[model samples]
Target: MADLDRSSDDTSVDSREDTSQDSKLEFTEDEETLIARMYSLLGDRWSLIAGRIPGRTAEEIEKYWTSRYSTSE
Candidate 1:
């Protein structure tokens, strides 16, 4: 029982680390250019755009694009 608890705790910690890492989304200059070009060609097709960029998910790219480009109102 104690070992199982420890195992679960370790898994939880690992998942938390992964989540934190995923949240810190940093795009390089080349990636930014690619994203812009892809947006022009694809027009909001996030999944298709993400498929072209290695190690990026559609949600991450969409979030970055929105935060970087969205107009403040």
Candidate 2:
């Protein structure tokens, strides 16, 4: 299991640069405002939240939120 996790991490690192350059994960200022509003209104229902935002999917939103906002503690 540790090896599996490590391999996945390695893959992510290898792809990060190429993916980052072409990624659609970065939200615009207006989009950020709208997402915050939607998040407040909808809570953790990312799919519904994503539906309200064009050009963004639930997975992308969830990944961004997890990486940016979620705390270990």
Best prediction by lDDT: 1
Give the alpha carbon lDDT tens digit for every residue of 1-73 in model 2.
Answer: 9999999999999898678746687878887787778888888899998898877889888887788778998
> How accurate locally, in lDDT, is each candidate?
0.93, 0.83
lDDT of 1 by residue, 6-33 (tens): 9999999999989877655878899999
Score every model by TM-score. Answer: 0.73, 0.63
- Candidate 1 Cα deviation (angstroms), residue 33: 0.5
Model 1, which residues run further than 4 Å from truth? 1-24
